[model samples]
Target: MKNVEIGALILRVVLGVTFFIHGLVKFQGGIENTVGWFASIGLPGGLAYAVAIVELVGGLALIIGLGSRVISALLAVLMLGATLKVKLAMGFLGNGQGAGYELDVALLAMAVFIIINGSKLLAVDQRFGKRQKSVAESV
Candidate 1:
C-alpha cells in the first residue's frame, strides 16, 4: 500500500478504538450517569443513548473500513457537537473543572481526513467498490 493508504488505515484504527472505548465506557460505567450529565449540560437526556450507539457502531465501522467515509462524517459531526456544546467553554487546554477540546478537535480532523480520502488500504468499501465495478463492466 502507498504511504497515504497506510496513514489512512492507522488513523481509522486509532479513531475507531478511541470512540469504541468511550462508547463502551458509557454503557459499562452506567449510561444513566451519562444521561444525567447530558441533562445537566442542557441537552436532552435521551440524546445520550443515540450518541452512545453512534460511537459504538461508527467506531466499529471505521475499524473494519466499512462505509468509512460515512462513518467518519458522522464521527466528525459528533466531535464538532462535543466541542461546541460541551468543551468550548473550558478552552482548548481545559481548566480545573474538566478536560479541554483538544482531543475532540484532533479526532474531528482525523474524521474529516478520512471522509475526504476514505480508508483506502484494506477497506471493505474498496472490496465492494471493486466488485461492483467489475460486475458493471462485465454487464
Candidate 2:
C-alpha cells in the first residue's frame, strides 16, 4: 500500500482503540458517575450516556472503516466539546490538578483529518463501495 494509505490506516486504528478504551472505562466507572461528572461541568447529565454510546459505536465503526467519515465527524465534535468545556482552562500542559487540552486538540485534529481524507486502505468502506458500484453497473 501507499505510504499515505498506510498512515491513514494507522491513525484510524489508533484513534479507534483509544476511544474504545475510553468508552469502556466510562462504562466500568458507572454511567451515574459519568453523568455526575458531566453535570459538575454544567452539561446535561443525561448526555453522558449518549456520549458513551456514541464513542463506543463510533470507535468500532472507525476501526472497521465503516461510516468512518460520519464517526470521525461525531468524534471531532466530542473532542471540541471536551476542549471547550473541561480542558481549556488547564492550558496545554497537565499538572497535579488535572489534565490539559493538548490531547483533546490532537484527537480533534486527527478526527478532522479522517473526516476529510477518509479511510481508503484495508477498509470495509472500500470493499463495500466497490461492490455497490459493480452491482449498479451490472444493473
Using TM-score as the measure, the top candidate is 2
Q: Write the per-residue lDDT of candidate 2 for residues 50-131, one digit (tens) a residue.
A: 8999888888888999988899999999999998888888888866599998899889988988988887887899999999
**Tens digits of per-residue lDDT for model 1 on 74-106?**
999999999999999999999989999999999
Per-candidate Cα RMSD to the true structure, in Å, reads: 1.0, 0.9
The 10-residue segment with the lowest total lDDT in model 2:
87-96
Clashes of each: 0, 0
Model 2 has how many clashing residue pairs? Answer: 0
Candidate 1 lDDT score at position 135: 100
Candidate 1 TM-score versus the reference: 0.95
